[model samples]
Target: MDASNPGEAPETDETLPPDDPVVAPKARSIRPLVMIWRQALKYPAQVALALVALSITAAATLAIPAYFKVLIDRGFSRGGDIEGINHAVELLFGVVVVLGIGTALRFYFVSWLGERVVADIREKVQENLLRLAPGFYEENSPKEISSRMTSDTTLIEQVVGTTVSVALRNTLMAIGGTAYLFYLVPQLTMWMVLVIPAVVIPITVFGRRLRNVSRTSQDRVADIGAMVTEVLGAMKIVQAFNQESRERARFNAAVEDSFNTARRRIMIRAAMTALVIMVVFGAIVLLLWRGAVGVASGEISGGTIAAVVLTAGLVAGSFGALTEVYGDLLRGAGAASRLAELLHEEPAIAPPARPEALPVPPRGSLSFRNVSFRYPTRLESPALRDFTLEVQPGETVAIVGPSGAGKSTIFQLVERFYDPQAGTIRLDGVPLTSADPAEIRKRIAFVPQEGVLFSANARDNLRYGNWEATDDEIWEAARAANAERFLSELPDGLDTFLGENGTQLSGGQRQRVAIARALLRKAPILLLDEATSALDAESERLVQDALERLMADRTTLVIAHRLATVRAADRIVVMDEGRIVEQGSHGVLASAGGLYARLAELQFGATEAA
Candidate 1:
């Protein structure tokens, strides 16, 4: 199948890291966090409430230090006045009560926003993923994509729920406390101001390094997740090959790599924290020493000294907290940027702005004209070379070819999964590209080599082909596909849960179920990809009978590997090296002694070829 345009470059090659899954682009800034901010803004009422509560809590926190100053000066230091002390104690209690209430509200609203925003983002990303063409998955790993959906979004949730709130609250405290410190003592405030530049410079330097490490750390973590999914999904193969030890070593290596990357990130964050703390609190100590001297000289009261000490501590602590939260914000930005890549991806195959409609009362005729194509991954060789064929309505044409001879490519083009680079394909006389893909596919039904079923009940799997099919209609189709007997014998009948990929059913039963699904589709055109190729003789006969019934009155295209399967086909087209070498009825092709005759001798013995 032509998975992508031969000339157009893949979208992932430009946006994603090259070759190495563990490598990631450096996070230059926190600007990518704006996407998260937009998602949070969707609930304005929650935002307003959270902000209001945060402000109230910050104000109340500052008020406590001021109240301490009042209590010391007017109550304890003023000849121990009982009434003044009682009044001060009561007011401090009131402030504490308000702070508790405000903090609770802030936590509630912010966490709600975090959960809601992540949920919405998941929905949007999955929706866009569904719209993307198969070409995207061919280029990118679904396992890596799954990690982004889980691990990356979790980082975003932490940022919204905890890091953002902590950063904002500390900012308010730092600014307000600084102003109050200045009011209390200009001399000390000026000294701390000089130390601010020292603290900020280290934060800026260490933070940049941290951002890069954090992004790489996330990539390594995603690599680990992808590796785990790959290994677990193929556990049976590993056990059969006796390669369990090798798989274990590979998983251990991935875990160690993830750990090493994370260690670098945390080390940078730790250094930033220690440096900012030493610079900020060292200045606070000097200020306190100066304040102590003033108290001894009677230049300032004891209460004034106490208030300066408390407020200065608050300001220094806020600066220290900012350094820690800054690291988390950068990590969140890295995650948001990765997710944004998927959310913003444009589908390479989409309906035209004004798509032409297919003709009603479907004629079911299909045609391919001078079609030449190559898969994007294999640009050196063509899958179909100048392929041209025409099928009349209600005719069954069987295609016979060796592996890589473009037999399946014909089905892919017919369904418009991809457009050929060099030719045009039409259905019912209308070009495939000119009409909406969904409308064109509605007229065709496909039954693949393996019967693909979802992890759902039998009824749901049957209805996947046509959701509106009634129970009576479903039973009728089941009978036509030779599936009614086993279905009726099932424990819950149609309601029975079919295991993943329908592992609960036998090979023949699964193929019959697939035929029943196509029967329910009720499309005028049917495409079968050797549905009974892997079945035993008895099973093959049953599936073949079911397929024959399904093909009656429908335009059918079948890829046949067994000579017996195509003997009844209206015409057999023999393909070799992506081109048709011969075309005729079974008897005529046998008499020609060409590629079909060769294939017949190999499958049906030399006597049958004659």
Candidate 2:
């Protein structure tokens, strides 16, 4: 990002640190000033108002030092009249009042700009994340996303809210003061001009190191956050394993890395600070010494020396401020670049320019026509290869397979979570890829393993499947899932709060609640992925009865690890290594003594074999 100073060149990629040395060795190219300006330009009227206020504030500040020049030289010089001093003092007081008001207004407007810009950047980044492909999250963590929205935005807020205005005010003041110095002593102003580069050089050059350190520090902080989130989310597992000390040690190391990087940044900033202060003030002091000698030799009046000194001091202070602003620009530039990468990433899955709409009421006839799929990261092995299947509407098909036999892959493809690399999946004879993914998902209800639940009321959790469901409808769904009995036993019943991940409820209870949510969806198609796995024998019997009833008139896909679950299924498709090994009714498949028969006899024993 180009900074306020046009003369100082911007840092290139070679100056920046890489995100990861092995995977993403190349540094990212992102211009933060572009984001800032884009946001600033969004509210042009507000920006205009703030800039006007800033201009008035800068003018007021420049007037103060000029007022002091008149006070010390013309008004209070030796042998000057006391009345002149009194008049000068009144003028100075008036300047102070104007400055006080200007500074206050400047603070209000600049801070407002900062807050608005931060909010816009955060909203944009979030929207981008939502549209991003699943692959993006696979590489980055939720912690990294959180950090970008928070700490990175805070850095941007500092740049927008504080640094920009400070730089502008000081810049104007410095220019005005220098002009005044030239009017008082043209020869002396030339020496002051020579000192400007001395201050600018260190801030520009050393600022590159600061930016690199800031990026590293932020990465370390994000690592710590990721570790904390992972451990906390699985606190039960962590405690069971007695890994508290291990987790703490990892977190401590992450924090120490962050601290070390921050220290490096601080050292560079401090050095830059010391350099600016010495170079600016030192040049002024040298000028002052020359001015005093010139005054003694009758070359200029005491008042002239005094006025020149006052303007030079104001200019010097402005230069010092510029140095600090330079550092912020560099640091903020890195932050902006990282944010832009996330915001600009295009999702691999996107709605077609003109997508075919689903039937208002879908008839769930599903077919896989020579469909093949392989995750992009694992392109060497196909998860599903030329898989072909067809089910008439309202048919219940059970899928039985060992692990990694493309069972889950089928569910994902059916829901349009991923597109098949070859051929197509169709719904009601229309290609699934051509249909809107949202439309396809809306017609399907998925009950995954382990029963995912949010920290919300029981009623609210069920209502998620059908947001507009009435209270009575929610109860009906719960009753169908056999959840109403336990729910009614609770003190608050439907209004009872389910703690995080439904931790307050037993495993069976959580599973029942999940089944209730699926029942509420009333989707034409149902997918059960070991939906009864968490339930105990009694609960499973009851819930299985409910699930059979739930699947009566809908097209259903069942992935069962247990043999008992598939006994009532219309047909069982046995799969091995991503291919269908056998397919037939359960009794027939068992009688045939194939893969299904082997699995069935393993669970049901010789009873099934006989």
Candidate 3:
């Protein structure tokens, strides 16, 4: 385990910037399903195979009822010709065996196709999500994204893999069985057709209602998932404040809303089932009475009556399955709509029509020319107003200010995390908006305020910064960040498994790991937001010394609250209310008695200010 320095104080709110405004929520749309399916059809061979299997299965299922007809008319009837009866029985058994074999192969092929399509969909969604701008994550919860990739994809999977095939096969069987019944007894078939209106009309109306409720239920479930994830991720504060009851109540309420919506859906489905059974069976019994009269009058043989009965039974059973699977289709359609909305969203940050190519190895020069930006959630005032600054190649600049002064917004603009609404930012004399954001970001490294770690080993975490780094290079970067000593001390050293979000590691240790990541990148530009704030005075000194060495030939932008860190900067820029209020050497700014002087005095006291 890495040693903890409890003696080190946590950074003040003044050091860490306020959370940015919430991203503007968007209404869900239904275009993505079409696009997803269109892309999925690129694998025509798989889809065609699934369709072939489905067709064969449906044909075989319908063929089963014909075997029952043969058994009833040939094997059960004593008046039939004995030699002809035996031959018919033999043929019936042979047909059933052939169909049973086809059923097994069809099931296997369709199921395999479902799995493949789901895997393909998830891979495409994840890759597109990764390509999205940082602004995408700022507005959406990780849970919301995960739900689309997981739960929504599962819905599509069921639809493609099972429900769709079942619906189609059952539909074919229903149609084919109905046709066969007409051939067996044309008079009884008319009654079945007459009852169709009674069943079809109610189901069509109620099924529409069920589909809407399904959509509401899915959206509510997603809300519950997202809320739980956000709160559970911050469980430390949730536990500290004794807010478990509150969170439980909140989650229960969301879940209850989903339950209620789903209940409404279930009620509609139940009603539809009752209507279908009542209509179809009621017609069957009425038609059987007519058949009984015909038999009494000797209009049809006992064997013919039995054959018609068997076909009628097949028709009713297949129709019932079709009705139920139709409800699943409605629900699946609702899920498809939700997933489609995410896939269709227009990314807030779009690349230029003809993006300018960035230099292979970017120079360290960075500049902001009258840049101004307002977050999508807040349009009242810009986060950074007419921000103008320039850093020479290989110069280190520290940005310091009071709360809400737009200190971190500068780094956001520099990294093109958000493009300015007005004016421009440039790297190596090329406008950031014109250059590819991906290309520009490749030249920069960021150490965020909170050290975000994936669930992985220490070595794996360090390697994220530079995937091609050799083991020696990774260890060297760890040493430069002052993290190698603690990493080496762990029981498993570099191979030691870290818990989710690196929860197993101390805050300072996580911060050191983040530093090691930045060092590994070895980009021409480094951006740090309270990189050493998690460490004790002693550890801070050690890590700070290492950071200074790492920053030697890179263009560095640091957001600092402590006067000590500002003093090490080659130049200091003071900002207030989204505007640059002061820019000079720390000593010069302190002597100027401007915003920087007051801020330094507020933190260091009047004696230190002197």
Candidate 4:
């Protein structure tokens, strides 16, 4: 459990359940908030400055009642001495000035720490997320993760910037004011102390309910975020299918669910606040009643009675503020626990310590020996079974198979996205697992069926394949890939902003740009997943020309469904049900009266007749 204040308990175990995808297992205590404290400690200077300011302001606030006591006893009681009254008033004003200055400084430093800490946390979480394997994403929603990065971090910011500061300042005031109350009238102070348990019991009981509801509330909000992202990203599909009403209904339910959860959370907090306030102030009213009796009997002086009332009120208000602070801390703990999960997630696919370096002067030879694999999400059916093949340097092998025949799986394995369950895959004779995944990828260039482009200008997107490529070298590759014509016609040439996923370019133009990117890579191995499958006849001809130039001196693996596209390849491999059933040239396969022959007959017959 987290100590009520920053420096209370030793650090507790931070381990959480490994498989909490929605919300972290409900935090039973604010121990998760200790993570935020550790992060804040990185800047000790700022923390020290903020603490100094907080202490000064707290002391100044408590000094106000003491000054009031003096103003009453020394100034007003002495036949209204104007000079003494003015002097006491000036001292009170000075304290007020000190309080104001300290508060401003405190705000500046704590807010700076909050923003800085959240920024560092975001960078750290994203850095770890980038290192995780794709399988992790398969198990977690990107939308929910995005919510964690934003919504959850905002809550952490509140804790660091506002809630924690409030907590510390109020605790100080409560302790100081209570001590002064004892000095004024110990009997009254004793009675108030007895009521402390009344206030504490409710906070402890209501706090548990609030913490559980807070976690559920955060999960509900994440669900709404995921829903909005999903619906907006698929708006076209929704309208085309005329399902807007259904989507709206679904979104409404999600929003309502979120609101309902939040309502439950606030209700619990409201009840806690009301109960604490009533108990605390009720105790203060009773103490003041007793103090009035003492004042009447001439036992307690007027100034003393006045100071006791003021100090007791300050103490009561501080205790009351604590209920809200405790709730905010619980909420912050929930947020911190979620982010900690992301920050501490170990990448399932990390580079091995002391990884073996690939051989120099890459030969581009790829060999998959009896590789059998299944996707993490679909383990019951293997995507590749005993998939054995070898492509020598400078060889172009086209892979043809029906959907789910493992053509794409071969590319995935080559990229080392997932390791095979059985058998070895090697690039140049080095087992892929032995070398670093980055080194393996640096030697291979891949162009998917749809050209994947970032939301960047043409120069950046083209240079993505080789960041060090010169402009002249980029143009040369662009010309070879037949992209120079349209690229030169682009409004700002290569500097033009290619909208999200290169939506600014036509299908054929994007494919050419992708080919130019691959050409710029100049890697020894190329993987093309039917680059021309989605283009029209003219576009296909242009992309085919570009692909031919790209394949000139590289060992290429092409996954093609259009039989006409792979006719001139050095060899063709036909797969079915995760196994290669046939391997031969297009001519040989056509004459063999096999699966490829039938597919070729259907596509070729249609093309020739057209």
Candidate 5:
């Protein structure tokens, strides 16, 4: 086992009945059936319709035995009227029609109800997932969460739409058929019902085993799904590294693991079905022998005997079918339990019950005082310690530091992605904790290093910065970011579809689009984190020119490792090991022979500070 990830259990063909958190978490009881069924009740009209149709179908099925009894005893016996025989045959055909129509109606309503319920569940799960904070994902892989959304939800859809409906219809048939058996031949039915205990005993025992195994089986399938998602999402990485054979081996292992678990579940369910059929039919054969003796003595009519035998078959058949349904229900229960766990995950960050409003016309000032923080996933290492800095309105302050010096940490703190373990952070003189995260984020425009763009059109991608932006405004921002020329070159221009993650564009082009997005935000503060790090000289010069104009009236914090990029900052702050070691202009720092001077020496050589 890899000890680093306690949450990710090793994948194996043999797993315990229920996994941690998926079905039973921290000793908390999970009743997925009850929870899922209660949700099914949300659509009252559909539930009622399904119930009515189910009842009609059951009644029609029960009436078929009555028709058989009438045809034999009243119409086919000695001295029987021909007219009576014809009427009995017609009545039998009528009952057949009723059964078919009722069955169809029952199926329609039940399937419709199942589909509607599952759709609502999917929507709710996704909506809840959106609200959870990053810490939740630190422990849970996106692959697993996505598996729950697709594989698990598909299982639930089957359970809700098909399994539940079949189980209900069979339940009604079994009960109604058993009662009709008694009315047909009390003497034979008395002896026949005795085998009920025999059938019930094995069902109870095997069902427990199947339910446990079903949970494990569903978990294994989810593993396969998670693996597929992970490998496919990084297909380029896998091919580049020439790990295709290794990945295929891993994928095959997961698939076989899932299949093995399912095999066990299927075996258990099959055993249960076999035991039920053997006992139920064995009892019926004995009942038939007794009925034959009773008929020899004229104790029961032939018609009654026939109906009793048919009804007994119905009872046994319904119970046998239920064994299969039991497995599906258990699988569904496990899925619902997993979804419920996700829904219950509490986010580390949430809006206050009544958040204080931000100051009108946001003043572009930011401050951090004696702040300390550690990322949740890397709690052993501090990302920031005793960090203190202040940026005045309309000032461009550039932070220069080596890797892991907490340059990006400041941006995260300002964005309220994580709260500091110690000290306070404020914007516009209001503590960040006192205001809603949305309000704080709205006042600062952020352009991340990677320049993330969605699989969407150019217009939609740019409009993401300001959803309500007009066409003219979008074009205006694109022009300012030096992206309008390339955008117009595309066949469909703004409406052109950018492939996944904007794969159709070059790195420099993607960066320009990201800048355009931030420019369109029109916020009071701008955050640029190595935005020009990956650009070529030509792209850098052009982007820097556009950036100069964008930063003219806004407070800007720039993180740069290329000393030349930030040489013109109003003030440069040098940091190392999460603490600011020097603060000054380019000339002042170079002449003092400090850490900044040494860094400049390494990048540009000894004799020149330029």
Candidate 6:
């Protein structure tokens, strides 16, 4: 592939960074663009108006040459009258006016259709992404997916809004101008039409290369986007380690790689455009020479020859423009196909056609029986093996374990974020698989280790758990979590905007806000996964106090690495590898002298011994 710029050299694959994922040949047929077109058809009124406007624009364009012919032969000929010439000029001006109006209408309708279609695609893609299982995300990066939603959708917008409109209008002019040329002089038109194959065959070949390069360019662009998202997400870490210079160098390399690929695609398209234009105008030149010969022999009039030239020029320009439009459509088709792939991805877990409803009065009981599972990305090692546990209604059961001991996996399974490879999980005696995921989630509240909060006001964040909660309910929940004081102290009290991920608040404040969110949820079951592990002692004590209040009259599951936090639970379950090694009160487990005893020694440090 040549570079997009005439003087630049083509970039080689060897220049790509080692970490870049090799782009594979995954684009399907043109069916994806067809799918997008189907969406455009949904707005029949806009499509119809656009088509009508397009016809007017094309017809007006084709009519100009006829009026020019009349102006030349009947108005400007030696024997022509001034009155006739003036009438012809008036007709020409009228055509220009009609053409101007037609062009504007076409632009308006075509642009509207493009925006509407792209908007629909973006909305639907986002809706689907939210429901896709975590396993899908594990296999794909979030940044790449986001790039598709933005960059790829923008490409589709260009096609629907501009490329398709230009192609359709040009097609009509090309065919119409050619027919008009025949009416003026068949002999010249015949020779011009014969030149079509020479240009088209070359376009067909180079266009394939351009399509391949375009897809690669898109992938490289997505790579750059993914890299930027990752780096920005961990900006604090990068700055803390003073890795800014290294990160900048890496990012520059990715950007350059993307530029090289894009340049190659551009060059291929440019070459095709130039080739088509040369062939088209060369045919016109040949026809002009023939027409001049006819006029020299007195067989053709000057006005007639002029009309033929005008129509031939239109035909040539239209054909040349088609080559460029072809390139855009191909690129857009590739983008549409990528988006289609995402849209068609079915979630790994889907609710049954008629999902069974949990018992009306919510019970917090949770039970896992003989469950075995491994993460999709980590298939070699089971995260949980033959794990069985039961937390009766209103009981607080704490799971204590080292990293990778299946502690958090218990919370994930309960949330139905994943399904175990074997055995069953049930809530309120109903098999989890039998109930809808949304319904099951409504009865449970989850607080992850890293408290999740969006960029919103304090009120909005608290209301996220219960969108319909009144202001008083929100205040009550905040007080319960000990977040009321800080929240009220914010610039706008409950209305203060939290930065991304609640960056405006301290670690403890975020935790308290998270607890308040869970508290507001008012669910019968609560999932706490290391919620207070990162907080300072004061914050931890406050958060723990909130947790205890939250646990009352609710079935709670806590995943804690610090055994001290779980010491007061009704029961403590110790897990190692993927199975439970011990289960009993902290005292019983300490006396049993197993994994729990050693962990207690490391954390609490043999309280009696001390």
Relative to the true structure, how large is the alpha-carbon lDDT of every model?
0.85, 0.79, 0.76, 0.86, 0.82, 0.83
Residue-level lDDT of model 5, residues 166-223, one tens digit each, is: 8888899988998887777776788878888898788778776776677667667767
lDDT of 6 by residue, 434-510 (tens): 89999999998888887789999999999889999999999998888778888989998998899999999998889
Using alpha carbons, what is the TM-score of model 1? 0.93
- TM for every model, in the order presented, reads 0.93, 0.90, 0.91, 0.94, 0.92, 0.94
Candidate 1 segments whose C-alpha is farther than 4 A from its true place: 1-26
| RMSD, every candidate, angstroms | 4.0, 5.3, 8.0, 4.8, 3.8, 5.5
Estimate the overall C-alpha local distance difference test score of candidate 6. 0.83
- Report model 5's TM-score to 2 decimal places: 0.92
- Candidate 4 lDDT tens digits, 1-610: 2111211111232434544332344556687787788888999999999999999999999999888888888765747777877898999999999999999999999999999999999999999889877777876778888888999999999999999999999999999999999898988889889988888998889998888778767877777777788788788898999999998898899788779988999999999999999988998999999999998998988888889888888888899889999999999887787788788777766678888888899999999999999997799998999889999999999999899999999998898878899999999999988889889999999988988889999999999999999999999988877788888988999999999889899877888788789888989999999987667787688768777866878999999988889888999999999999999998788888889877887877734412
After superposition, the stretches of candidate 2 with alpha carbons farther than 4 Å from their true spots are 1-30, 78-82, 298-310, 488-497, 608-610
Clashes of each: 0, 0, 0, 0, 0, 0
Give the residue spans of candidate 6 off by over 4 A: 1-29, 608-610
| Model 3 agreement with the true structure over 321-430: per-residue lDDT tens digits | 77787787766666665544454455566789899987657788998989888986577977988889999989999998998899898888888878899988889989
Q: Which candidate, 3 or 4, would have the higher lDDT against the true structure?
A: 4
lDDT for model 2, please. 0.79
Q: What is the lDDT of candidate 5?
A: 0.82
Residue 69, candidate 5: alpha-carbon lDDT: 82
RMSD of 2: 5.3
Candidate 1 versus truth, CA RMSD in Å, comes to 4.0
Residue 519, model 6: lDDT of 87
User: Model 5, stretches more than 4 Å misplaced?
Assistant: 1-30
Q: How close is candidate 3 to the true structure, as a TM-score?
A: 0.91
